[model samples]
Target: MPTGPAATAPRGDLWRFAALSGVYFAFIGYFNPYLPLWLSELGFGAFTIGALVAVQSATRVVAPYAWAWVADHTGRRIRLLRIASTAACLCGAGLLPTPGWIAPHAGYVGLVLFLMFMNTSAMMPMAEAALAQRVSTERGLDVGRYGRIRVWGSIGFIVTVVAFGFWFDRMGLRWFAPGVVLILFALVLACRQLPADKAADEGAPAAPPLRPVLAQRPVRWFFASAFFMVLAHMSLYAFFSLHLDALGYGRDAVGLLWAVSVVAEIGWFLVQGRWIGHGTLERWLAFACAVAALRFAATAAFGASLTVMLLAQAAHAITFAAHHSVCMAWITRHFPGRLRARGQALYTVLGYGLPGVLGGVAGGALSEAAGYAAVFWAAAAAGALAALAAWRVGQAAHKALSATES
Candidate 1:
């Protein structure tokens, strides 16, 4: 870990950090729900859309680790963050020319978008590393404080989702690209205002070799479990709205369903600090995996029922929020200093990027063959496997803790 001058960094810096975080997630909230719609507006077929989205996930497999390595070696996280924010904003603006410049050329557009999103995708893992460092070292703060700041990101996401849904309904998809550009610029300004970390200036210690870290049994299990858990999410993330529409729900209703899940996730972020101290990390991970199993199973079985859907959506608190918090906590414990960024990148690659690419492709194929219901059932099986992995993690952790006590 890099250590140098430590003075009271202003609380305002933390708040600005929160703002930056919020702006970052707002981009995702808008993109996740709206990107396919925007692509379809350009007359691309479903297969083309799936292929293009896979390009984004494919980039993620390399982009975040590449960016983190540069930041860790150069020790200039904020500078890199600013560059990424600016580039992504410009990319968003480029998509907004009249007559829909990129829309008419779907393959060309996908190529350009793949590059743009790759640049943008590194932001989340980098931001987490930054926040974890500051939260751990700064006075009058702890890991719990990180959640308070992160909740704003969820709030920002909700704001954009609701706002874009309404505007897209009224004015049409033409406004989507420009709206994203405006938000990205706002993110740039927020990034500029973030507090400087002295550790980045002092130079991070050389990270230990990766093989030993991966060789750790807990780390291996966590990654395996995360991969399966995210695989279970493929159907929900990619086709939930279509499933709802197929069952006779309106656009507004679909939006409301998503909002409910996000709201539940936010609630968990706000309250999870209290829960964090109450259980072992392995137990929490197991609980999250179990809930994920239930959440996917419920969606598979009762997706069309409004009441059951609401209840299943509420499990987002456990499925995503609790799972994420425990995973980050585990990483923070295992990987410190220069290693934090790499650890986060590894988590994102296996936990999100790999599953996103594989799951999106597989889910698309399976849904086409068997129906959307089968997709969720497959997701349920993935979640069950994740639960099994988590249980093993818990067993190993409990044995370790017992050995330490003895």
Candidate 2:
């Protein structure tokens, strides 16, 4: 956010931003798939693990916005990123067993996770806002440039998920907390490499109120679609590891399955610019949601078959990578300039936060009562709803465009 020379200087070193993204998501690759497994290793029940995972969602509901608002007003996103990363690293250390100090009890572990997630959750929104400013143009997001940079995150995730998957398999999950701390420490280092500029608009007029933007029909439908799509994905984020484990899949196989999805995701991100422009963003969102429906259904019904599981994982190219690109395009269009950070935060809150909570708590109960297959079935239903909502978003956008051109 630095003015003039300082602001322009960092543009030359885009890899710094890429590095930040890679390291952060690398942490995610391990944490999301393995955290529940670690808790289970510590003798926690499914419902308890679900509730603890919900802690991350609960913080996402408000923390990102709070951090973004401060960054928007102060134009110090990099500084905030450093603070969040450092704080999260510190809190992650609490997960380590230190005699009577850091017990693995539910109350103790839950609090540590809540604080860690609260800080870590803000990183992506702030980083995206900063990166988008660098890569976006008057026409829209520079898909090629953005894709080239963002692909590193996929690379990072794949590396860690596969490596840690094998590591935990060979050794044990007792080392999980230490791995988490190490990754978080790396995130702090990554943040230090980013440019230290503040946005030039620190003294500019206040950003337009967000309510009017929210009132637009297209915007409403867009959020609704995101909500359901991400809600459906919670099955993967919250329970995919446990699901495979329950079915007797080895930890190495679980990691390989996760890596397969990221490989597909990486392929899509590297070449998305070529295909993203072939269809409207809304149309793409609709397609992604439709694929999500199929993907989750396949995951639920045929999870026992390795071939079917591999095919389903491969669909991450469409279900996550493409959907993410389209959503970023939509958000960049809807909230330009000073509004960017808050816009990203709203997406996190509505799309991931609320649905994550519902998915974790409710999916836990459903999985406990009916089994993991039932949870994925419910996710498939959410995906179907998301497809319908995305279609409505396309309709609303077309109608609005027509009104304006007329």
Candidate 3:
């Protein structure tokens, strides 16, 4: 059947969003790879940077779900985007205005934490759930097709991260706050172009807004698995620059290593559907966790060989991205309306929040007390536990899904 004009519009909407994702990603990408580097540049010690990073993660733990709950009840997705993005710009821009105000020596930490709470954390979970819901239930939608659109975010991440690191070395971290503000403004414009969700029509049945998300077993397990995995996953990012710095790598080399990680992220997105075709989603997640276990191990052991470090970075595809895709896919397959958004929020809160907060602090303490080697060892240990958790979750999900069919 030929499509109507309205039906054709969402595909157009997605392309618009693809650009937004790229823009949104580009805004934050510079920091994702190099924030720790920046913290080091500003005469920061490891403990102080870790505390600052930990605060941001702590804010994310509660904030995503709170906003997601508001979105679910009000059915006000795009409105949240405008509010979230605008606030994010101001928050990031605040760093430039209010340096060293939080404490005598530790000001940027407070600034970044406020930014994550106000702006960046809410943007992606809301967008991810909205996009996933559209592609999941909408007739004629092809989910596998998302990879190409999402790849632009990776492209944005790589370009900005690699280039800006060089710029930071030359022009300095003074450029970070202002550069981030410009990129976020671009994201706000992109968000303005998104199609709004139509959940509030009078024809729809009345229901209580913001249904509790923990009612589902699959969701609980998925979030728990995400938490443990991300706890381990973030350790690498929160400290790998420091790890590399200790290992005799320069700022430029660290940027390229970070790029190598995201390149693997893009490659994983490219092959994920096919990779899952060859194995169960459970198998893919388990494989990724297992790779994470090794990736951390390699980070600890292979400080001298940049080649091994580069190869280890490639494991991000399996470790972070693949684990994320599996969780999102599970939500799409298992969750219904409103719950889907809430579930994504829960994932953000728990996955990035608790684990992230703890890992940043723990990775720092571990590095400070023992060394970078010990931090990766602890991260690997977390991954080992995550692998077990993933296997348990998969087995449990398989049984429950089968039981539901019967």
Q: Write the per-residue lDDT of candidate 1 for residues 9-55, one digit (tens) a residue.
A: 46787788899978988887887777766766777655566566666
Question: Could you give candidate 3's per-residue lDDT for residues 1-406 as a string of tens digits?
Answer: 0022222336787787788778877865776667777677777888777877677688787778788777666677778888898888776666665344443257545756566455678778788766765555343223355565677788888888799878876787766657767887788788888877664422344324434546656556666777878888777768887888888887788888888888988987776656555666666667788889899888888867988998898888778677767777766665556665677777788888889889988788878999888888888888887787778777877887899999
lDDT of each: 0.78, 0.90, 0.73
Candidates sorted by TM-score, best first: 2, 1, 3
Q: Which residue segments of model 2 deviate by more than 4 Å?
A: 1-12, 98-103
lDDT minimum window of 10 residues, candidate 2 = 1-10
Clashes (backbone N, CA, C under 3 Å), per candidate, total 0, 5, 0
- Looking at candidate 3, the ten consecutive residues that score lowest on lDDT are 1-10
Residue 108 lDDT in candidate 2: 88
> How far off is residue 253 in model 2, in Å?
0.2
Q: lDDT, candidate 1, residue 178?
A: 79
User: Tens-digit lDDT track for model 2 on 116-173?
Assistant: 9999999999999988888776677777677888899999999999999999999988
Each model's TM-score?
0.92, 0.96, 0.90
Candidate 3 ranges beyond 4 A from true positions? 1-9, 98-104, 107-112, 137-142, 199-203, 206-217
**Top of the candidates by lDDT:** 2
Order the candidates by lDDT, highest first. 2, 1, 3
TM-score of model 3 (CA atoms)? 0.90
